[model samples]
Target: MDRGTTDRTLLSPERRRADRTRLIDGVVDVLVIGGGVTGAGAALDAASRGLSVGLLEARDWAAGTSSRSSKLIHGGLRYLEQLAFPLVHEALQERSRLVTTIAPHLVRPLPFLLPLTSPVWQRAYYGAGVALYDALGAALTADRGVPTHRHLSRRAALAEFPGLRRDAIRGAIRYWDAQVDDARHTLAVVRTAAGLGAAALSSARVTALLRDGGDDAAPVVGVRVADLTDGSSFVVRARSVVAATGVWSDDVGEMLGDAAPSLRVRASKGVHLVVPRDAIDGGEFARGASGGVATAGGPDEQRPGLILRTPTSVLFVIPWGEQWIVGTTDTPWRLDRDHPAASSADIGYLLGQVNRVLTRPLTPDRIIGVYAGLRPLLAGEADQTSRLSREHAVVTPAPGLVLVAGGKYTTYRVMAADAVDAATEGLPGVPESRTAQLPLVGAHRWNAVKDAAPDLAAAAGLPEDTVARLLQRHGDQVGAVLALAASDPELARPLPGAPAHLAAEVVHAVTAEGALHLDDVLTRRTRVSITTPHRGTESARAVAELMRGVLGWDDERTDREVAHYEARVAAERESQRMPDDRTADAARLGAPDVRAAV
Candidate 1:
């Protein structure tokens, strides 16, 4: 009955080693390499379908592309411009599924405004387009929880959004989409996979693939893994292998020694800048559109992309909890694939675009947070990365190896399903996937429990706001978090510098979420480092203490963690100030991770 407190040691080093041992001893049904949203989803899918699954990641879960998304879970309405109806429809369906069924707490609806430059024709045009978007959602989920689109005159638009530029808009068409905390969502999927009996390991790097039978073997029988935390190497055998690595997909394919499986994948870098809440005054779902509004819906529709005035990007801003997150530039990137640094040009481009329509201009001093994510664009024609398809492709050149590439974040679940389906084709006794109806680790009956939690909130001595925050992050498992605090009341205290997060969360990340280092906790688990002005300095010691018990860190280890964290923050700060990518990359590399002692 208390499945809520499942005693699975998901992130423990000992449990990870034991799981790795199990895979080497008995062949796993599927071995998933990569820990982003798609790979994490694949692990959950395979395990839920009764396949013995082993998932290995070189770094922490969602530490790569998954964590760096624009954090929206919506159908690609822009794809409609390219006449990519199937992709839009599929993404719309997945977005609805995530909000209504899968992880409602983590994903919620956000309203977007398409500011019309011309009232009459544009309103009719965009209204029909958004109507179609709503229709697609209806077809996807008959009772789509989101409201339909609405048209507003210029005067009405300005009245609702006083900060808007008077001349930039003719009117506005507001429509609904969804947003999510990307890293949290990915972490949830990985945890869900572990709960479904998948052996999950982080800080376990896959160095190479070991072919079965011979060098020219038909299927990849196993992978050679190096435990990065310790200097040890081992082999993990599986009946089928899936490479769900995002931007690194092509490189992973290279390891398999086959003619690259014609995946047109390219990495496009997108950046989001986080600013103080004082920078924007608007609700979370506020939206505005521009010139292309009227032409968006017709059969021969082709219009200039409408700008979303997001934090530091277009001045079209929305309230995100405590801060205003702005930006997102869709520019081509040619650089080292992993850890794409935001170039000065990229930042300048965003600032220029966003400042154009803002009543008050934002200078570089206003920036408190900056993150760049790579969109894995399925590559396309000469000089056009934007034109590349967001559609996904799965190719199996060899029997044991499967590669999935090129899909939007909203469609990760769909992409994962397809990847697993292809990879598990030859696996013995693999049951049909049941993930469609299965709830994630923390999500089962969440709504019902959350609806009935006022008494529980009072009993736990938590304010309503605190209870709501806990339920948002932990879903139906808030009771477990409460129990953590019950064992030690200190866990209930808010993190020193980060009032929004509880110390219990930092503890839980280590105990359950596979956060191996302090950076993992600060940067990914809680996001205190990026969102705060001190970048988690004041809270580092507090969080370090929370980790000490779970990770067996001595005083010296804790000091080193804190020192490394400080250096990392300093380096990132320096990186952003640099004038170019070359300088930025160098600045970022100034703080190398402290390697485990030999």
Candidate 2:
């Protein structure tokens, strides 16, 4: 029940071409229009029900908000304060499933130290809330993946996280949640779907919806797709079209020429900061229980991440490899949805808030990466973006188009199932959602294969730690990466400038992970873009060359890929330097996207 089907796991260049040709030549039961988590989930959901599904993404998978999240699959403790019990309960249940069953290797238990600034009343109030959260997890989850909430004294909390300023807390509350490599997890989902009878194609942009009728009464029959890879255009017929485009939901109406569904999905920009472990006061806390970098989704230990309350929202100090992931200011965003810019003021505000409790405050130079993502919230009368609803809505303004929008990352599966249910409403012999029992591609055999990391590393002449990290990222597919390294001695070497990453990952990004461009390899496939201070500029050229043979990129094309990625990184750096969003947006627009086919 847990094993992924053997449809087509390797999404190689050959696979992409064949799938594109197949999609152009025939019709699918369902066509998913986004490559983010939700769209990937929708494709999986429909495909699992024995329906033909075609997934299309303008860029690589998880190219948008899915890649740039807080990276926590949590129950949202703040939502409890707002009395959204059902949402919290649902998220907690999903968290339990992900950690225990669905993606154990990709999602894991992460402890959080919530330093309390107030006295007994504040502790009592928050204590009850956390207790309720644990109770919900206990009731919903059979295995109960994470530890129960533990109340910690100020001294005890300080003993665990010495990075915190001593005077900032009266006491502390430690709770357990889950963290995921958001982009990797999303990729795994899409890959699993592809492995389970789904035609997956990235770099394919849907130009317009094809319909039989010419008027508003016309039902969508297919999509006019433009392949960004070859600048080729084609059309694929579909019985149902599910649009899980998140922040780009409004654009569907524009695509439909004013006949599309009316669903207001407002954008809330959330900015994150990636800083080095040494930037914090505690040095030894950076090491995990497993003697490697302390990671949120990796093996858990006394190394707990920090969660502090800010004036507007909560700020998290998450453990990500050698760096700490600090984030998220929720404010309205009306600019470009593709790449939401994180301005200098945004970073300043974030640092200023987190520094209030940090014994060793981080400077601007301390930040290795600053990325921003937009949250698609269901809009209502509330003007503030934070006040908008996180619950999703499914609508069919036309006969064949199903629009699902406004849900949190934690509830993506539920949203996708709901969307698929709507899309396949009148379809014949559709079974119930089987994704609950379906494990992603790498997850099924990970538990059995995980402990063999050291042995496998020995056989491959690589470090045990490298093999270990590979298992966590690729799960059971660690062999695929290790084989690449074993075949090529150069790939076994650590990537230059970003030595934390191995060169083999670059090649694997192309052959298996659907990485079409240099940006896809650096930014999403592996986290070189965010982890390295160079923003992947130093790794871009070597990475491009590694991918050249796999993708048939000649000398000039490979050079262009490297150059394009460098320019994009420069543009992002320029954007982050600007004082405000408007200027930042303008600055970020300096380097247009490399795939300008659309």
Error of 2 at 504 (Å): 1.8
Residue pairs in candidate 2 whose N, alpha carbon or C atoms collide under 3 angstroms: none
TM-score of decoy 2: 0.96
Candidate maximizing TM-score: 2
Query: What tens digits encode model 2's per-residue C-alpha lDDT throughout 467-520?
Result: 878887988888778888888889899998788678889888888888888889
Q: Give the C-alpha miss distance for residue 534 in model 1, angstroms.
A: 1.6
CA-only RMSD, every prediction: 5.9, 2.3
lDDT comparing candidate 1 with the true structure: 0.75
Per residue, candidate 1 scores C-alpha lDDT tens digits across 484-596 of 77778888888899988888888788877788888888888878876898888888888888889888899998999899889878887887778877787788777775443
Which segments of model 2 are wrong by more than 4 Å?
A: 1-7, 282-302
Candidate 1 TM-score versus the reference: 0.91
